[model samples]
Target: MKDRLSAFYWLHETQFAQISSNLITSQRRKAIDIFETEGFPTVRNEDWKYTSLKKLIAPNYVLPSPFASFDEEEQVEYKDIKKFLVNDIDCYQVVFINGRYSSWLSQTTHSKYDICTLGSAWKKYPKIVEENFNKLTKDDGPLVQLNTALAWEGLYVNVPKNIVVEKPIQVLYFTTGSTPVFNQTRSLVILAEGSSAEIIERHHSLTNHETWTNAVDEIQIGSNSSIHWVKLQHDSPQASLTQHSKINQEKDSKAIVHTISTGGKFIRNNLDFSLSGPGAEAHMFGLTLGNDRQLVDHHTRVDHIAPNCSSHETYKGIYDDYSKGVFNGKIYVHTDAQKTAAYQQNNNLILSEKASIDTKPQLEIYADDVKCSHGCTVGQLDEDALFYLRARGIRLKEAKALLMLAFANDAISDIQHPSLRVKLSQLIGRKLGVDMSTVL
Candidate 1:
């Protein structure tokens, strides 16, 4: 695979090599070397066993440039903006059209925190980007390298020490243009010591044309800090989306990530957490609602390198039609990480006879005193529960919907914000045709 370089190969390679040339050190050069040796992961790789990148490799997409800006009415389709008015968020909003940032649509307003787009940030704060931009993640992965080489517009967020952001920071990425435009956006988030904030990163497609969005986010949480990261992916069904996020946590720091995927023909999420400090905690959570022939794959890995660290992950999926879902979760505890605690579980509900799911939950602990457990369960709705609800005067459809809602309620209730949680629950109920939002 590494030797096979099609016409599109040069398109990505030139950009990556040029970017590496801008850096003084040999780190970026080494990454390019690794990328050349080990192209994209195939089915043979355990990490990419279920999800295939064939479509991404087959249709060679063009790197998008700065396109037209969204109108006020069209902007409402994004999550952060309310019409033309900006909501009171912890950090500023960075708007991206196609795959590039729009300076006209973006404002320089900052909270008590620091915020800037990657393009503007690189010009103003080259030291920060040089010091940390690609430090936390690896470029060995083909898509990672591809994103690095072709990254056009990105967001850079920095939280001050000991300050708790009062509101959530939202970043809106909109995809437009025709001809399977390729969107490779990168984001860097730095949480200072003892700081806390909630971040909402969303991917939305305005047009129904064929588009591909490949995004990469690198987050670093300082000592005693906390970050709540929410990823809401709703792209066009004709689009293909791939997102990868790598989070590094320090001592006493806590990072919580939740992902909700409902759109796109082929969706794959690679969420990795590295606990580098003792007493650090990490939580990985996800929910996916897939129908038709859509495919959604979630692969997560949490590595506990320090002593007394903890981690927990739970993901649930509901599939209908001939849709397929995949969940692969692994918890790894180093030998020296004494007293480590880790737990992982995945549960999937299949709605149709043709719907299928593949789940694998594993724990690899070298420490003898650590406590770790992992498991996965795949099944259909409970007929007994449905019958019981129907016997109590509820309709069959209503009973099934109610049970499904109950199964997903735990995850929805875990959301810290009340209004958002309620809204999501109601929407879920509506999707299931329960119409029991009033009671919920």
Candidate 2:
């Protein structure tokens, strides 16, 4: 807490004005005040009891310069970062280097739709940023507040009404610097009525420098619209990440969010969905593969505010070595939300004796006519299945990997994009030390 406070004080004194302008000055100040009053969440906070930021916050991380220009000698080639992209897929790409937009490496469009950076939108279309910025974010968390106060560069996408984007949009953030640094980024996505789009967001570190990223995303789906949002976190082991996503759905709209976390030393994800109108639906899925001493925590909430709304959530984790995992999910059916249907499930597999997992699924229903259920399971590999596979030609490592793949396929099958599913499957196989190229 002291370290965080000291860093905040230093940033407030040195860099606050540089990051804020007349349009966002007041909002930044309010956010900074909130962070100062609330501080970092501790075990006393019910929502964060299973996860702690003591180690992540202990370092006195230097805030990266927002407008720092890279020299010609420091420029990164596309070939160096192309391996992290989905090479088989044709999509619009937006790349950010060290918290700044890389126009030379980005392919964006402003014709039928708006696909650009927050900085561009703020400068060119101030009204759009003014109308949507900070509207969906909750002011209850300190990390989010800090992001609100300091976020400068990220993706901004707006899909017009009745238009179906044939291609997905890929937004990638890469960090490259000699010194350990901290960064804050925000993304805003708005889908108009009857529109549909797919978006993929990822974070990667090119250097081994210790880094911390605080990211926030706000998504609003209009009536009869749909969105498929996926987040991939595969940074270096020295990196730490904290992300929050708030999604709002209108009448007859649909939202699907898939989070895959396979890297980073420490990661915490907060995902929330609000079904604000009748017939709205939300589907949430997550897969986390943690090894070594890494820690991955996911906290999710689905609020059914209107009648005839529904939500489905499933999360699976595989922990190896001395890694730890946490899953906390809640379903809230309001008093007026009759005929609400909500279901949640969390499962985990601990591969080593030292690996651990903590899971809690809660349901709060105020309407008597709602149907809500939640269940969780935690155990080791199925010995019977392992033996069955080993009895065949499969080796022990291959058998274990096959079992884990089968376990994660439950969520992987939900992916709507074929190339993305295959890419994720290959990454998962590599993480498990198995060759899945032929199987996938």
Candidate 3:
């Protein structure tokens, strides 16, 4: 902790003035102060009880510098990463390498909507960026504050009023370096009234080097607008990821988010939704497939602050080979949030004797006329179902794989993109060492 603080202090002393010149300087200073006081979270923290950052903290990871020029080497690396992208789908692309925007590999548009980098937006239109930046995420937390203080570049998207973005926007982050590196990134998305958009975010590692990413995203859904967001996490086993997303919805707006976590060394996701206007709705779904000592933890919260709001959350996990998974979901209905409807569910499948899971689903409702329900289940594959498949002359390994895939498909089926769904199915099949050509 001392070493990390020293590094941060050095960076602040040198770069804080330059980075905070155009933006709110006091805000950045305040965030850094909070991080300096709180430091990294440990097991003692209630929200972090199920996960620890000891290993991540021990690494001497330095902040990566922005690339001055794109060379042949980076071009080759970009080509190698193309295989990991959703190529079949046409979309506006925003690529980030080592936390810095890469224009050579990115495709952005401005005719119908503003799809660009936060740095570019901040430079070209400081007033517009100032109006929305940091407005939604005002809470104080260690990781979030750190990102606020150090985040250099990330994607920025805006959908104008009554405009429907036909193509999905793809934000891809790739890590490549010889030494251990730490990256802090921030993204913002704003949809005008009556507009709709679809977004896909993904992370990948091009090298085996140890990398840690702390990312924060803030999204604002306008009145009567809608958005569908998908996050795909498939980094190298040596990568550690911590992501925090805050979403705010307006009257009659709808927001749906889907998260698929398949690869990582240690991953912790914190997702929060705020229904600020009446008749707002939110739907969240997540799937985690872990193996070989991987640890994945998801913590989600939904706040119904207005009347006639609704929310639904469903998370599923499949653990094998001593892997561990954790799910904690909370729903809060305020005193004035009458007629609120909320539901939460979590289910897990433990495939090995050493695999384990910890799940908690809770609801705290203060409104008298509200409907809320929460439940969780942790168990193994049904023996009867496996036997039923085996009785039809299916091999044991194939049968087990089939059952596991079927169990996870419930969550995958919720994805709205056909090509993305097929890609994820194939990735899951490869991870399980099974051939899903026929089933998928």
Candidate 4:
């Protein structure tokens, strides 16, 4: 797998020469060398102890074409992509087809602030791209290094100081093909001090062919600013996604992330937050539903580098069939981070006897004056409650679905966007419908 990816890198450098600036080019150089040396993550790595990359990377996957050229009959329609979008939400849309930008289906902007693609950002505002690109992942793992080595099409959002974006931005990546494909996508978001914005991102596969996407996002939030980021992972069973999102927060800045994982053969999420400035706050919430031999794993880190900073995380999972789930979260408080408050919780429901979950929430506090808590729970639905609903004339499947829906709703109820919450509620219902026949 490493050799195959190296061939792609050499082909690119040989064909296109330099892709970005001297600094970014150097980053690519070092990244490829590291990837060639160490290769992908394995079970020996502490962070990836529970998840295995053997099956995920063993496929003979080919890199997607630069131009997502499809035949006339194979063309994509708005209706084909519309099912994945939120209903009646006023937003700026950014759409990509097989890692290539699709202008016709996207509603990008440049009137006040930039909500465009990374390629456009490099061509127009090269300075901004150079300053923030690949900065957060310098010490990251080989998965991130591989992305830096061969980064492709993704979005870029820049909300200047004190300017609030008029509408939310929706970014979607749609993969279509009959052959196995491997893609690398990266995005950068910069919110100047006192500015605020909201963004939604999703990756979908239109076919059952094998599709693997390794994605990375680097976001910087300035002082007195706020950002709401949402990730919707619902794809075909043949799809596999490994996502890494890094967020940096300044003084009094706020960032909230919501991960809604509904479907996929294999899904791994690594969410990291750095509270660099005092009074910064970070919130993370995730809801995952796994069935039919699926695997969903989430790992998060919050570093309290400054005093008066607080962070909260809540993740819930419902797995049926032979599916599995894993959650490992960490909160680190530096000595200088006095008066820090951190909270984390993970809850899961094992609908089938064979289904299982592994959760480990940790906290390392060096600050003397701090309040922190971590806990996890794994169990099945309450038999008494199920009997009450069944006695009230509800069918067994309906009763179980209702109980699971109510349990899953806790993680998403805090979402500030009404339309997205509604859409996700609908998606969760549809997701649970698949298990209605076997959940009991």
Candidate 5:
């Protein structure tokens, strides 16, 4: 596998030998450097202690070819249900099929905000796209580098200053199975000062086929602005996904991120938030429902560089069958970041003996006047509570379903969007394979 990586590096060198962009070529070189130094992360690494890539790096695997055309009719179908909407927020939507941007299925209009493909943005605004493209992630990790090296099309959004857009913007990515295809999707969002908006990222699979998706997102919020970001992943059971999100918050800015992972073969999400100004606030929330042999992992980090900043994080996972879940979170407060407050918690519920969870919540505080706390809990359904429910004339299955649904009530009810909240609850119930009447 190591030899193959080296071979891939040389192969791309010859493949993109005549590319014109100096900046992109420079990034390619930088990626090679990073990969050379870091290589691929193994189980020995502290961050990847719980996940393995032995099968992922097998010898027979190859990078997916660049896809220029795909049948729109063959794309995955998504019902516009309640979980797909929220309140009266009419949003601009963009849809992608099999890693290719589809203009026919997307909704676009010229207003205070703009949405377009990454390739188009690069061709139109070369300087801006070139300067800030991969600045969010400098790691030479395989997935990150793979995305940088093969990225062709993605989403680019720019919101004008002082314009409080009244509608949310959605980006939906649908993967079509051809041959374990790899989709490298990139998103860059910039919110000027006094601008505010909400962004929703929805991911789904068109087929229950094997594939790998590497997605990277970069977001920057100006002073006195707020941005709400939500991500939902419901890929096929044979598909694996890796998503990385990097956000920079300015002074007096507020940023909230919500991540829900429900379906996939192996999934890992890395979310990074950096408060570069004083009086900034950031919130992170995540939920995962895993079954079969699925493995869902969430890693989050929040760094406070300025004083008077606050951050709160919470993540929960439910596992059945031989499923596994992992949560690693860290909150760091610098020495000069006085009066900083941070809190983190992770909880998991296991329904089968074969199910397992690995959780780690850490806090690194350098300021003496700061308040920080972290905790994690892994447990099973309360047998006593189940017995009581059954004793009240509820069937065994009905009682268990009610308890499980109630256990997940906190996450679902905390959702700000009424429609999405209802949709998530119903989908969760379906995933549990329990009748809603029994639980409700």
Candidate 6:
């Protein structure tokens, strides 16, 4: 895998030279060098102790080209992917097919605020791109460095001051599945002061062929602004994803992120938060449904660097059919970050005896005046509650489904989008082999 990546980089390195600025090109060069030096992570690495990249990287995947052209006779349209969209809610779309922008499937803008591709933004909005691009990620790993070195075209969103985007932005990335391919994507979102936005992002594969996606997102929240980011991970069983998201918040800003994972061969999410401004708050909620031999992990860190900042994190999982799950959350408070309030919890239910979960929650505080708590629980469904529901005339399958539904809803109850919540309920029910659309 290392040699393949090395050769691919030197061969396809010129694909980014035309679209990227000098700063970006320099960063790409340094990142590729670092990745080549370190190579893909292994279980020996402390950060990836529980997860293994051996199975994911052994496929000899082919790298995607930036100029890979689709056949003009077979173009993608909204009608082709209607089942993937939230049918009830209105949204602005940004679609990527095979790591390239698809204009026909995307509804973007330039007048109200820039919600377009980084390929154009690098040429049009150079200042904003230079200021926030690659600025949020300081602690880089091998996979992240790989993305930085190769990914060029992705979603670019910048909302100016005092503006509220009425419609939610739906960002979708799709794989054609014509061949086993490996791709990287980068997204940068900047919300100025007094502005707020809601976004829904998802990845899907049209075919069950092997696809590996390494994605990174950098979000900057200005003073008194808020951004809600919801990521729905329901891909084919052959698909694998490794996503790293970094969020930086300023004074009185709020950052909300949700990761709902149900289907994927192997999935890992890294969420990092930096509360650098006083009065800033960060909220994280995640729900993962694991079945079969799938693996899903969510590793999060929240750093309290300013005084009077607060953060809340909650993640829950339900596993069955020999699946495995992991959750590791850490909260750090600096000495100068007095009056910090931080709370974190991870809860999981293993329905099958062969299934398992590993959860670790940690908190480190140096401030004199701070409130911090961390806890985790791994258990099974309450037999008494299940029996009671069954005794009330509900079928056993429905009863178990209801219990799981109640358990998962707490993490996403505050999504603020009714249609999305309903759609999620449908997805959850389908995954559980029950009908729960009307229950939500």
* Each prediction's whole-model lDDT (CA): 0.75, 0.86, 0.85, 0.87, 0.76, 0.88
lDDT of 1 by residue, 1-440 (tens): 23333223454554544433367124445554566767778889877887887766666455554333443433334343343222433445677777667666665446587677876666666777777777767643867765665564677887889988776766778776545566778888888999987877777666666677888888989999999987776556877788888999999999988887766788889898889999999987788878888899998888889999999887888898999999988788888899898988788899999988999877788889998888788889998999899999998888887888777765555677766666567666766766866756
Candidate 3, 1-440: lDDT as tens digits: 54465366555644655543455555667777788778888899989888988988787785764423443433434667788778889999999988878887889988899999887776676777678877766574788888877776888988999999999999998887776778888898999999999999998777688888999998999999999999998788998899999999999999989999999888999999999999999999899999998999999999999999999888889999989998999899999999999989889999899999999876788999999988889898899999999999987887888888888877878788887898888788888898877777
Residue 394 of model 2 has an lDDT of: 93
- Any runs in candidate 5 off by more than 4 Å, and if so which? 1-20, 59-89, 437-440
Give lDDT: candidate 4, residue 280: 100
Question: Could you tell me which residue pairs clash in candidate 3?
Answer: none
The clash count of every prediction, one per candidate, is 0, 0, 0, 0, 0, 0
> Model 2, range 1-440, lDDT digits (tens) per residue?
44564456455644555444565767777777788788888989987887888778776665655645554433677997899887687889999877788898889999889988987877787777778888888464888887887788899988989988778999998877676777788998989999998888898887777778889999989999999988898778999889999999999999989999999999999999989989999999899999999999999999999999999998999999999999999898999999999989899999999999999887888999988888999999999999999999899999999999999987778898788898899899999999899888
- Better candidate by lDDT, 2 or 6: 6
lDDT per residue (tens digit) for residues 1-440 in model 5: 55565566567664543332668767867776666666778899888899987665553433433333455444544453234433365678777766677676777644667677775676677777777778877663766776676566677887778878677778877767545555678788888898887888877665555666779888888889999888877667877888888898989999988887888888889998889889999988888889999999898999999999999887878899999999999888998899999988788899899999999887888889998988888898899999999899988877776777777676556567776766666677778776674344
> 257-328 in candidate 4: lDDT tens per residue?
999999989999999999999999999999999999999999999999999999999999999999999999
Q: What is the lDDT of residue 284 in candidate 4?
A: 96
Shift in Å, residue 14, candidate 2: 11
Candidate number that wins on lDDT, 3 or 6:
6
Most TM-score-accurate candidate? 6
* Model 2 worst lDDT window (10 residues): 65-74
Better of 3 and 5 by TM-score: 3
lDDT-sorted candidate list, best first: 6, 4, 2, 3, 5, 1
Highest-lDDT candidate: 6
Write out the backbone clash pairs for model 5.
none
In Å, residue 380's CA in model 2 sits off its true spot by 1.2
